[model samples]
Target: MPEVKEFRLPDLGEGLTEAEIVRWLVEVGEVVAVDQPVVEVETAKAMVEVPCPYGGVVTARFGEEGTELPVGAPLLTVAVGAPAETAAEPASAESSGNVLVGYGTGAPAARRRRVRRPGVGVPPLSDGSADGSADRSAVGDPAAPDGPEAGGHRRSSLRGPGAAATGGEAGPVAVVSPLVRKLAREHGLDLRALSGSGRDGLILRADVERALRAAAAPPEAVPEPTSAVAPRVPAAERIPLRGVRGAVAEKLGRSRREIPDATCWVDADATELLAARRAMNAADGPKVSLLALLARICTAALARYPGLNATVDTEAREIVRLPGVHLGFAAQTERGLVVPVVRDAHLRSAAGLSEEIARLTEAARSGTLTPADLTGGTFTLNNYGVFGVDGSTPIINHPEAAMLGVGRIAPKPWVHQGELAVRHVVQLSFTFDHRVCDGGTAGGFLRYVADCVEQPAVLLRSL
Candidate 1:
């Protein structure tokens, strides 16, 4: 006998509301332990494995892979206190000690599996329990209504645009892909109205496209009967802005809407900086990166002009100047661009910054960067010049006061020592929130950065 308990999706933090099921670790009738990862889900921030709190036999799983569920939606039901052939001891209905953002332990109790008596209207839970009543939803039954087939439909429409796709006589609309769901929603197509051409009547992107094409065709106009082959109709590809790409889009949009931003540019001769970096790498135990040298210069400049290192508290009408520098560096990966923050960057040496930056960059590339690794930045240093571009007026990362953009350092003609010569020149662009400070502060910050780039010795003064 067992008492059934349902576990819902827990909040992964930072006000995220939903996540898509990337993988499922457990199945119905399988025994599980407390705090065991039951599913891997992808939120807007990162991928996380969610664990179940109850240790018991899995009775039901609510969602399939690729299904997006809201924060409070039921994920699965576990039958606790169940007596199995491999039972170690008598079980009681109790929860694990660990708690997530929106999940908690329940009261301890014990109950038997429900049994319908003689002339009873309800069905029994399992045939093995007490009086040998047959369970309608058996684990081995392929025709069970609460099995995988029905569960996919229930999870698909939980918080999606296809809410109408659930529960009908012909069975639930077989939609598994989120893109197909999105396509149907965009064209105002009812998924329940069409039969999917896929295996087990699963709705795919092609089926949604076919629906769109059929609906868009003119009622009166017909194709002419001609020997010439018809031209192929090109369909537009739509990518959903939901994960890291979506977060970037939303943040950038908000920054443009709220911040009165200004960009100032100056070209600097980086011959000396390059020479110093080469010399450091030649003599140092661990080689320092060019980006690290630039970051070192940035921290020094920020120390001189603290006004640019602050964010505006709009409601309080006060500028919040941060005491220590938590520097964020922009790194572009296969998934999308992410800014990994280096905590207490102002205190790190050039070699130390290089090491941390390398570690974070590798993490970003492998998509292992945590939410903590990606946030809490007092300032950002964007070295976009690695893309071989000279300069760009990049949109500021929202809430942060300013960003320092460094362009590619290349040999160019410049006036040096009262004579024209080829020198390593780089363009430095600074974008700052006007709400934080006037042009004087912004100009001072950029000027100091350019000075350090021109003369590496200028940084040693602050060091």
Candidate 2:
């Protein structure tokens, strides 16, 4: 027998006790080297890749993809050399940590996963075993559990987990998030006939009640303790928490906590900026968004006032500056918020910046944005202006010295040609880490950005 080693899930970061397994880079039977990326997991912030801690032949992956696993659980078993005693054989029940108290191997939540699914927006099942498969809940008959019917009654179903959704009579059903499950007993819900729209068809309490309301009312006046049908138990599986989400929560929290900031704002005439956009949109391969223009302006401004683009090392008592600009554009996703970086924005043109920003947005919407897109942002732009807001102070996306919030462009009274007139005005709010950039520096950078936007022709010449 080969010498087998179990890869127990490590404390990814933060105080998170569990994570979801996103994907496995290395499959069973493949030879893996130490430190090679073997799997990807998500905790809360983003998906993180977990490298193999040991080198050997991959024996078994404890959980299925997209499952959440608790911390300190075994994720994979590897068979080392020699007689191959390491991992070819299965672990004993005791060593396997198999029990009802916590999560385990059937679900491979190796790490926190930030990766979101695009088309099917099913949030992960808490147990981590959502590979298009439904399982029996502890709350009911594993197979053919009768669900709550109308007026707090139960309905029966002979069909099993993989069976098709039936028509004609609406069976037991409900709708709700997982947090509502605790109220099941109080509300008197039956889980069996519950056709859940949840991640893996797990019966949510709302589904329980909806199913109950849709079914025929019981003839008997008295309410029963439970549903009508309860079949024999089916095979159940365990889900393991991978540590992916743990790492993300740690990173986001660290950023929010350690970074200190100060902010300044200015209203500028955006007629030129708007004109520039229209002209660019009329002729470009990829039309530039107001976001790309804002990025270009900020990168140029950072060139002079690098303080606004610096990174603060609060723990190390150090501040670092960069030569090029990497602007993280915040991409809102259903799972959560994500920011994908646009590398070296200064090097790219208005059109190039637009193309890159468009690409990242598409990837984010499609849930295909890579980890590289999510990190290393030297500065950030929150285009609240696009939402038609006049102006508001925006929080700094930590480490980076400052973040700019662009407010709406609307006709407002302003001095143009030494006369008060109505002009398209845009509000720019710049929040900087005061430790690195004083108010003057922040004000100066905002001024520079305004200059570029006000005289877009100069932006072309300056480039």
Candidate 3:
């Protein structure tokens, strides 16, 4: 006899409680291997392929694509230990260790053919039925008067259709999608009173919407008006803030509400920096990137003004100065803006930094960056100059102390060596949490960066 198992969605790290289903990798009636990716989900941080811990024949899947499921919701069911004729080998009860936060799986199992029991009343695997028998009272069966199809209306067996219902007790409401449940709750609709139209009598959003419309409809007895009337206005389009956009909104909102922040800007002649970059790239070694150079300068500036490279612990009422710099650079991709962190950035050289930045940028554009790659930054270097902008007061990434914004480096009129001349110049804007440091420290840090930008050799002293 085959033992059926239920696989629920696990907690993908970083306190994320829910994720939207992007795509399904496996289908019902498909054989899956241990620790094999079964579904792709988009959380607040990034898109992740969640692997199933159990290796068996998939019997059923719960949600559809684009459905947002909370942690711990049932994802699918697997029929393990099927008969030898059905599978290549018998499945062991042991699972491979710890694939996600909550679940584990054992060695990969051989592929097996999907097994289907006779009839729809077969209780779900969660019901713990040793014999593979469908629950006859399952939803959607017309014969199931006391089932979910009755819309929670329980009746006395002795009485006919006109008899009063007994107990006023209702059966389970067949609603699966959380979005549908939320919609009904927000509109104050009773799920038990409405029968579902979906397979298995599962309630859907369309059913709820139709009910609302019918409730709001005017009486048919009202006579049609002969006079011309104004046209009806179209409803506005709504976009849900759920995945990356929602995360950004939440972090930025918290930054604004909790942190007392300030911004300072300065314009610098970047001719030497540009010349130095060209000279460095001209060498036979790895080519240096302008952003990498800026990042290197930021690290040196933080070394001198470590106060700006720290976070404020509100509970302890103290500034937590980070020992090493984990630099985050903002990259805009088709999905949205993301800040991928470069670990131990202060320890990397110019060429090393360039390599890391390029790799992270590529990962960000391809939507492959992990949550670990997106978090833990002591400072952020935002090169908005790529957008061809002059300057911007960027919002500080929450929990981090400061962010340095670099604007477009273009030819500009400047007084160079006591003469007015066209020079490559760039604007530097620095935003910091006032709670971490005073304006003096912030100004010094910005001045140091601007100095390094103006004179590339100035950075050599720190190196």
Candidate 4:
């Protein structure tokens, strides 16, 4: 007989505690290889494929699709040590080490043991058997009561249907997912009052949603005719804020609540800057982007005024100035807006910065950026000009001291030297934390950036 091994969900990095099952790659009784991706899960950070460490026939799966599970919950069970013809190597050799962030498979897992509660007994599977078979009751079906031969434990509801008629006592609630409990609590719905339609009477998210809809339904009553006709009202739609959108919301909200910020804007003549970019790209081995040129200007400004390149330590009541610059640029994709950082950006030249910015942008658009790529940003550059806007007051990314916003550069009427002429002009907006610097420092930084935009030669002095 093969030994059964239970595989629990491992901790995804970046302080994520849970993930929702998007899809399952393998089914029950299917053979899986060592370190093979068994399921696809979506965390608050990104979509990840979780690989199983042990290689054998999958015996049981715990959750269905769209089910949210916390860390250390049982994901599946695998039966190892199959017949020699089925497996090429022994089960002991098939075990892997360091598969994910937290757990590993160097030794065989302990056998499954049941722990009895004070006044409740462990219920068997829906089929009243101990064999590891696929449970179909998870698909909105009520489970049958356990027989005497199985466990002799009767499935009792707390306040479900027919409680007043039988006058039965309340039992343990059949709920395991935290998401279901949260949904019920938010809507002021009592989980004990409704009957579950899941495996072994386990309550699911769908049950709570159904109860809410029932409560919100209007009562059937005849209405009297009015003098004027009533207008039809459209139904409102609700969307759950989860994944990338949810993360962005929480961070932006915290920034608004904590940071006392101020914004300053300057309009600069960018005709010379555009011409300089054209000249640089004309003879460069790698084409330099306009954004990269702006980034180069930003690095030069930070060198002159290091006060803007720092974060406030609230606990220590100190402003810690960072030595190196990890520049972050905002990129909007189909998923949402994401900031990808360029490590040691101050050391990179125009060509190097262009290369790194291109790589990170591609990764962001394809939804392949890791948590590390999205964090540890010392400063941020937001180019909202891509949306064809003239100007915007940018919100500072949380914990970062400052952000630079660039608007679209277009032809405008301006007094060039001694004559009124049509020139390419752009708007630059800078938002900074009031705690880091005063108005004079923020104004100096913005003026330096505007000068670079007006005359590219000013940037050459810093270079």
Candidate 5:
């Protein structure tokens, strides 16, 4: 046998399980050398090219474009020792440097891990990290360790199945079966929390719920194992997070959890800005909203106060300032909130802004926005005023320094000439991450935005 090496999915990034196959760079029997760009895979982050680790004859491709594959699964087959493995020119190393995802420095799976299902190497439902617990010898290979016949996973360590599989002092294993893990994941249940009541504590879906119910209940209930059902809201409809709603939930959750927010509000008269929008629409051109006009003002103000137009890295203690202003237009989809970026908002005219907003809104509603469109936004603008909201605090998108919320542009009584007069007044709210800016800085930014909306001609000075 000509030394055939199995090139399983290499670790792409830290803690990533699977990636969508993007494209294949080379064809079978094309005589590829080592470290050549073999396939392109798309993760949540980006499309990175995976390079061939061993040099040889092309054997087989494991997947097709758009097919997502789990890490450690065979991607392709290449027979080493042809003019291939050693045939490459020694001086040309740049050709191999392009290989991107997987094959990194993270440690492989834990030692003596337990198994729950087949080929899927999901760890056994366990809360505590894989440390001291369970029989260390129930199976063999720590990485795989999927229990054979335990659904399809190969059994690695052999704690005599005492863990959940057999149920003894042994805790949970990291490896889980495919079907069980999939079910658990779909239900938003953490497998680790489950105390399997199966044969030896082998976790089941029922077990997952039981564990959840137990955790959700107070500690007093464990001793009195009576027939008292826990009073909880059963899901009207259990939903598996996927598609646009899933993406939105994930992004918003990250924004809410990771970003600290402080808000500053100011009153802005959008009378002139509204007029500008109407003029642009009356020109029999692309229709625009006050949002488009506000975006223009924000683009200008960001130039003045570059700090608010930047991103704050809470851990790294760094602020990334983007040069161009790509305003994120918040669209309320039936699914959830999706903010599509209007790239280089400063360069586009009012008509262009209007058109792009229309295009993005249509795409968001239709679920056609691409993944690339979702990332790389420097700042965001949310207009709640369309819904009659008069200034509300909005969470800042993670990493972004600030986000602006526009309230209802309704008539409000104000003192005009020493007497109260009705004016088309609006409230402006700005939420910024204090890690990057102070209250004074955020307040100054809102004031600037307010000024731009009230006197639209002031913005013309910059133009």
Candidate 6:
């Protein structure tokens, strides 16, 4: 007989608790090889293909596509081994060495004796005698009332409807999945009073969750008799804050609530910067991006004002200055806005920063950016200018001390060289956590950035 092994969903790391099934690669009764990609799931961070460890016939699949399942929930069941003669090779022969989130490759699992219904594992005795009773005793519960003669049986670990029926007066409730029962227990719901919508009236987790929600819903308020009916109120559409959007919302909310932030803005002449960029690109190997140039400028400014590249240690009542500049730049994607970080931005040239920015931006747009790529930033550069805006006091990416916002650089009327002229001009807005420094430090940092923008040669000293 083939031994049935159940595989559970593994944690995809980064503290993700659940994933939604995007697609299934196999179906029931299909033979699968070890380490085969069984299902593709979308977690809060990224989409991942989960592989199975056992190579055998797929006995069952648990969740449907589009179903969201918690980590450790059953993914599928595989039956290992074949006919007695052909399956002489131990079940360990099908064990996989490839490891996933929760499961790791190790010694083949030792076979354990389990009580299962007939046609599943061991056959039950036909005679209504001592042999049948002894079989029941071997699998625990000699006291169980479901005997061979009763036309129903019970498994020690997995109790079906028959086992529920054998539980004295109330009999057995139709529940096969333990997750459903656990959900009911956690929510203080009684399964006996609810009707299940599953096959053979088996209780499901959705049923339990539905019962919980119904129990939680407030009672309808009684309205007194009125002369007129109230006008129908418009219903507002609600978008679920999850995935990238949820993460952004949480960080922004925290930054606003905890950080005593202030903003400072200045207009800078960018004709020289544009000319320098053109000259560099005209003779360069890899084209340098304007954002990358701005990023380099920010890094240099941070070296002069180190306090801006730091996070607040509220518990310790100290500001912790970071050593390396892990500069994060905001990129707008189809999934929403994401900030992909470039490690050691201070060490990179404008060209190097440009390449990394391109790679990370592409990854962000494709929704392939990992959790590591999105976190651990000392400062942020948000060029909202791409959206054609002139100025914005953008929120700081939480835990980071400051964010530099750049607006559109266009031909504007400005006093250049003591005369009013149309020059390439841009607005630079600096938003900093007030706890990290006073207005003097913030003003100094903004002034230096403006100077770099006005005179690109000033950055040569830092380079």
Judged by lDDT against the true structure, how good is candidate 3?
Answer: 0.75
Q: Which ranges in model 3 have alpha carbons more than 4 Å from their true place?
A: 83-94, 99-227
Estimated TM-score for each candidate:
0.70, 0.58, 0.73, 0.71, 0.52, 0.68
Evaluate model 5: give its lDDT: 0.62
lDDT of 4 by residue, 1-463 (tens): 6666778889887888888775565555445666666666667766666778887666667786556889899888776654323222333426676646332234433221111112111122221125644432221112222333213445432224323335663433466554465466557677777778986556778888999999989868868666677866866756567777778899899899989999999999999999998998899499899999999999999999998999989899999999999999999976688889999999999899999999999988776677778889999999999999989998899899999999999999999999999999999999999999999999999999999999989977877
Tens-digit lDDT string for candidate 1 (418-459) = 999999999999999998888989999999999999999988
lDDT of 2: 0.61
Span of 10 residues, lowest total lDDT, candidate 5: 110-119
Local lDDT at 220 for model 3 = 77
Error of 2 at 200 (Å): 16
Cα lDDT of all candidates, in order? 0.74, 0.61, 0.75, 0.74, 0.62, 0.73
* Cα shift from native, residue 263, model 4 (Å): 0.4
Q: Once superposed on the true structure, which residue ranges of model 6 sit more than 4 Å away at CA?
A: 29-31, 81-235
> Clashing residue pairs in candidate 4, if any?
none
* Highest lDDT model number: 3
- Candidate 6 achieves a global lDDT of 0.73
Every candidate's CA RMSD:
9.9, 13.5, 11.7, 11.4, 13.9, 13.0
For residues 1-463, write the lDDT of model 5, one tens digit per residue.
3344456677765455777665555444334555665666655533455677565555456665445788888887655553322222221212233344353212221122222321122222221224412222111333333444333534433223234544454433332333354445555665555566665456665676675677557655446557887877656747645434555677778988877778889886667677766777788656776677788788888888987778766678788777888888788864467778888887887668777878888877764565456666788999997887797988776667799898988887877658887878898999998877899888888898999888887887778
Clashes of each: 0, 67, 11, 0, 37, 3
